[model samples]
Target: MVKRDGLKWWFTVAMVAACWRKGVAAEAQASAIWVMGDSLIDSGNNNFLNSWAKADYYPYGIDYYRGPSGRFTNARTFSDILGDWLEVAAPPPFSSPTTAGRRILGGVNYASAAGGILDETGQHYGARYSLNQQVVNFETTLGQLRAMMSPANVTQLLTNSIIIVGFGSNDYINNYLMPNLYASSRNYNPEAFANLLLNHYARQLQALYSLGLRKFFLAGVGPLGCIPNQLATGQAATGNCVETVNQIIGSFNDGLRRLVGQFNDGSHPGAMFVYGNTYGVFRDILNTPARYGFTVKDRACCGIGRNRGQITCLPLATPCFNRDQFVFWDAFHPTQAANVVLAQRAYSGSTTDVYPINVQQLAQMRL
Candidate 1:
């Protein structure tokens, strides 16, 4: 009788151990993510906001769902892309209507139009929310999440969440290190100005670390010299990329990479910075514009003037012969197709020149 009882007890204990292991495995598989940054990642969240940096207008989301007028409404932003990944990974029933009926992996976009790390730099153009303000907005969003879930739940959500930050373009272009078209008072000296801007950015990252954010997918500076706005100024003889501006951008990106590395080591050991090589990617596309089916590498697909600059490409303005072939949609932004391609490259780790660490690797990181 005693021998039979021992066998039964051991079997019961084994069953309990197996069940506990399964539960842990399930938790390990699930994940959440959040995106914070500027116009590059900004979805229609800014559509409600009264800002000139809005892209919710027609032609913005045209390629995805079709019809020019419905572009921004149907278009997928960076957050949308990240949300899609989280769905496959965690499979969620998210609360937001935008992500409703979709998998419940927790995620939100805190990106804003014309936002930067510093208050002064962000609002340098005119009236706009600085990068610091966006952080505050992120905190507010977190509070709302906390109200809906327990502290432990919230922490778990954030702990598993991978935060992607995309910014610096606006800061270089519309804010510091360039001539402010809107404001006449402030002047920027490129080298000194970038140092100041980066210092502020470091602070913002530190603040987010305090909030339980560990992993970070950071996009580096892109080829700002190749922007249609800069090219259209009649600076490029052949209307090619502006080398001087590109040099400044390169320097800034180098500094940013070093700064992020420092943060990943010193204070935030768990943080991982993923550099998005917009510069090399765009440069390659420009070098082989025809390969991508782009007819005009020097000019924007949409916008006024033969060289394609001066303002945003409206229906009233000159439209491209074939937008699918063009890399740039307007003076500053890329077309939906280009954005999609870039997102794929980022996810697949195919972009060795630009993205040293792809999203797939970033998603798998424990720290």
Candidate 2:
């Protein structure tokens, strides 16, 4: 029999080897995570843009290790948390000057604040990259990848990678909903508006698919009616959400879900489209805040006015110390704590959170 010290040494070595193998397996499962969305997943692309919907100020990254990295949340965004679970490094923003060279191999984040599916959605907010523009940016990234490796190799890399597309919220929140500034509301009803957005969205997805993208995580819009910004408007009664707004957003999400089904019906060969039910997940959290370890679910931890949402968090604004207890970070975005829940659900949740299969399964799918 081996001595106790020898057994201990062998056990430690085995544990280390097992951990190394797990890490390798995770990294091999998904070569990269290409994120494309609005402020919810934007890492810092808006910092480079001349837009008013920026969040590169104090209290934004207070809970993050790298303070104030331009993320709208207090810490990591949904994509950042998902990357941590996948053992993949968070992709630097395409607008970042240092996103060239070997860094392009990991992936690239093309999300921008106030960005929407429609090109004219956030035009009033100044320069913001719409979903179509983000796709064009991805094309540029693909071009750089071709320069670094053979075109076939780049294609293979992308086929094995996962691309997240989260839009539509800004189209409603900043466009259709803001009737004073945009003609979308006057031009089309809710159903017609959703169809128009979906048409544009379908074309954009086809463009990405044409470029060799296979695995897609289509995140549906969340319950915007429950956000502190909407609550501050007095449209919703105290401690209650605006059901009308939620119903309107729900129609868009329903169309988006069907679109995912259409894409998976052999229309796009080798393409696996998964619909992330952001609406359901967020509503679940809201309905039972205690289950998520949140106390202040109605108001924002930062911001000013009624629900602390009349104005978003200002520069050097003193945020709540109990940020983890609050659901909203500012008027719009979720706290890092809430982001953790959203990412976890999308990464390994059931059909109720992410339909068909979650991100973990999507990553393992060898397309």
lDDT: which candidate is best? 2
lDDT of 2 by residue, 123-242 (tens): 888999999999999999998999899978998899989888899999999999999999999999999999999999999999999999999999999999999999988999556687
Provide TM-scores for the models: 0.79, 0.93
**C-alpha displacement of 139 in model 1, angstroms?**
0.5
Q: Each model's C-alpha lDDT?
A: 0.62, 0.88
lDDT of 1 by residue, 14-104 (tens): 4355457655664432266666777666654465555666655555666555343222322455445544433422222111245432223
Give stretches of model 2 more than 4 Å off. Answer: 1-26
Name the Cα RMSD for model 2: 6.3
